[model samples]
Target: NLASQLTISKSQPIISGIDDIKNGKVPGNRIGLLVGSASLEYYLTAVSGGNPNYYPLYSRDQIYQNLLGNKIDVGFIDTGNAEYMTNDVYCNLTIAGSGFN
Candidate 1:
């Protein structure tokens, strides 16, 4: 399952929950979406509602790089990968919100 959620930089403020994203709470945040990914599909359908207010990167590696580089405030990524990236690889990043497929 491509269950996904948000991965945020440590320096960025934490969102309360996934509702904040669906309700457009983080309007000023830059969301990084992997192209052709389930997370992108979710954002397009549920979060963005067809609006494209995000940065489109092409790889899972790019997601981590962008978040670590501060190129994006948040990354919409698969839950497991996001967890590994946050907890194992990029210790300075954090997984925010909840998982959804």
Candidate 2:
């Protein structure tokens, strides 16, 4: 049921897209994520079957800046925050799609 839900909707699965995933030059890409957030930790665990490399930012604003400047390829943010972030000028980030991290 969880897997089905993840595949079907953007609500529960909380996925982010890789620029490389859409473009042809590269295949899979790394996703930036928050260190303390349980959702991020869960996604990381699920993807790697263990912990993986993640960049820890001090503030959400810092993460927004990084996303804007392209320092990090992509990030996993909650859907509620995602809406605001996309609308924010500093980030100007967009939701690429829906899937598990």
Worst 10 contiguous positions by lDDT, candidate 1: 21-30
Give the true-structure RMSD of model 1: 1.8
Residue-level lDDT for 75 in candidate 1: 80
Kindly list the per-residue Cα lDDT of model 2 for residues 3-67, writing each as its tens digit: 10111122322343432333422212334556677545565555434555555666656656665
RMSD of each: 1.8, 7.7
Q: The CA-based lDDT of model 2 is what?
A: 0.47
Off by over 4 Å in 1: none
TM per candidate comes to 0.87, 0.59
